[model samples]
Target: MKKLESLPVEELLDQLEVLVDQRDDGKDFLLHSIISIETALLRVIKSDPESDYALSIVKIESDLKEHLVKYGTYLKTEYRKDEISAKSTLKQALRYDQTIPLAHYRLGFIAYKQQAYKSALFHFQHAVEYQRLKPQHKMSLSNQQSYHALLYLSNSALYLAAEAQQQSQKISIHNDVEQTKIDQLTLSPLYKLIDANSSYLAQHAFQITDSEGQRGASWEEYEELIDDATKDALILDMTGREIWVRYGGSAVKLTILNAELLRKLMLNSSETVPLAKTDLSDLFSVQSGDIKIERYVKSISRLREKLRNLKLPLDVIGMVAKPLNGQDTSYYYRSTEILFMLIEYAEGGQ
Candidate 1:
């Protein structure tokens, strides 16, 4: 999926225009296009609205509202009254629940684009909540549950990214010289999810990936990184990966801890020291390939001893300590955060 957040303005707007134009172009999928266009427009709204762009967005937003009114009427009249088939009704309900999250996500992305961190937060928060409690669409139990978690993570990432940008002071919204500001709130739900589900998400995302990796090379956006032992390395719990999306038969899996970590991450703001492993097994459970937990312990111990010999703070340096007893951590590390830590623990072996 295209990360809509970083899209160039022209490309994003052009994509939106295409969808919007097609909605009224008398195509068979006009209604679907209408929804798609409307959703994409929310994304565009977060951009700095130049005078050149303002009127167009205003018109698009207006048109989208009109379409919603009309669509709702259709649902009440034709679709209601037991006229529509069960399947059709189900599809509509699912669509309804999906559309809001889609639009809100777009809006949040836009806010980030325009550097309106708080507004972006508002929209993204709505998207996440819509994930937990919603229109209750989708008939299949699994699809419904998956969709709920997927959007929850997706929205959480947007918020997380926004907060990260703020605290890191990397984002500068230069509306004018003196009006710029920072937005801070890190390690939200997605980070927790990554810490907990790093293994499963990596496994699933990699299972569906159709790309390859090379030494010192970046992944092809969709490729999974395999460790020397050859298991799908969820080394990096991508905040975005928690969308709970499955590709083919592969999907990110999480243990009971994954959910709990995510819940706490979303609610808490303090930095957490990672939980140390109760034993190597806990840490090793998440590892794959030929790497044995015993081997990992021996290796880690060697590394620690070496660091101690160097008179370095083994506790503060070298490999990051993980929480095995369940406590603070700079909690809420995205998938990538966990991945980085594992890489260090593995002594940077591919």
Candidate 2:
């Protein structure tokens, strides 16, 4: 097999013509030859040649995209080079043709890995929007890939909203204008659109909201990452912004605050140990006697109902009781049937 570049441009073209002739007869051979021709053309273009020698720039750009995306995906899967090669090739593809949706998607995926959610959002939006505008014949992004892009877009917006909510909480801004901005940040229309596509994402969108009254679930059906054993045992995984609970052979993802409340109960699951309403109020950042404790109490009651419905041993989580002296009540969980684990991120890292 002669090196593709060793052949002259005319010779490569002649070979490509022969490959086209054999396309139906020798499909494998034709495919191999097409790849060879594409590689040779890329080499020629990279050589800074005087002319493309009758090669159409549009065709070359289109072919390069397929090659780059395939090779880039391979490199990404291999994980040996850490995606640097794939990223560089995709960047080259973008330089060759700015309108290539795959190139933009690859770049956006890289940004997502780097946790540059804002940049990822921008690139993914462009890739999806531009690809949508192009004719069907020119479409390079598959339906599944487009769906994934939409998911990533929604997740990015959710992350941004979560971050903004966290910031607003830190400052405790009371002004109506600042409050409105915080509300907008927490309730993004983009997330609602994404959530509407699936019930799982809709629950996710609910968790990410700043709504204090949102009902937290132990786990959502979409969270397949948590194993069956965990679900059967009614275990709770607190990682990321959501708390995943497993109960009644069903799983639900709960909000961070709700998970925190459960975590507190789990830590003090011994009968000798109990969490006072005042302590719970402090954990929730509310005054000791504030009416907000009622909400926290309601959340605990919901959690208990979920656990009881699942028939999990609730001995660990005793109950909420009123003190005989008319003082504020305390909650306790003493059963060992339920287990809790703290996860730092989606990968289950510390």
- Which candidate achieves the best lDDT against the true structure? 2
Candidate 1, poorest ten consecutive residues by summed lDDT: 341-350
Residue-level lDDT of model 2, residues 1-350, one tens digit each, is: 77888777668767765664454222322443565576686676557657655345445556546555544433333223435756776776666667777677767868877889998898789889877877363435755457667877777777777676777766765654345554545445645654564454334421211112222222453355355554434456554323466654666655434555676676554545566665565333111223355665676766665555455655446654665545465776554545443332221111
TM-score of each: 0.22, 0.40
Cα deviation of 199 in candidate 2 (Å)? 8.8
- The lDDT of each candidate is 0.37, 0.55
Off by over 4 Å in 1: 1-99, 138-350
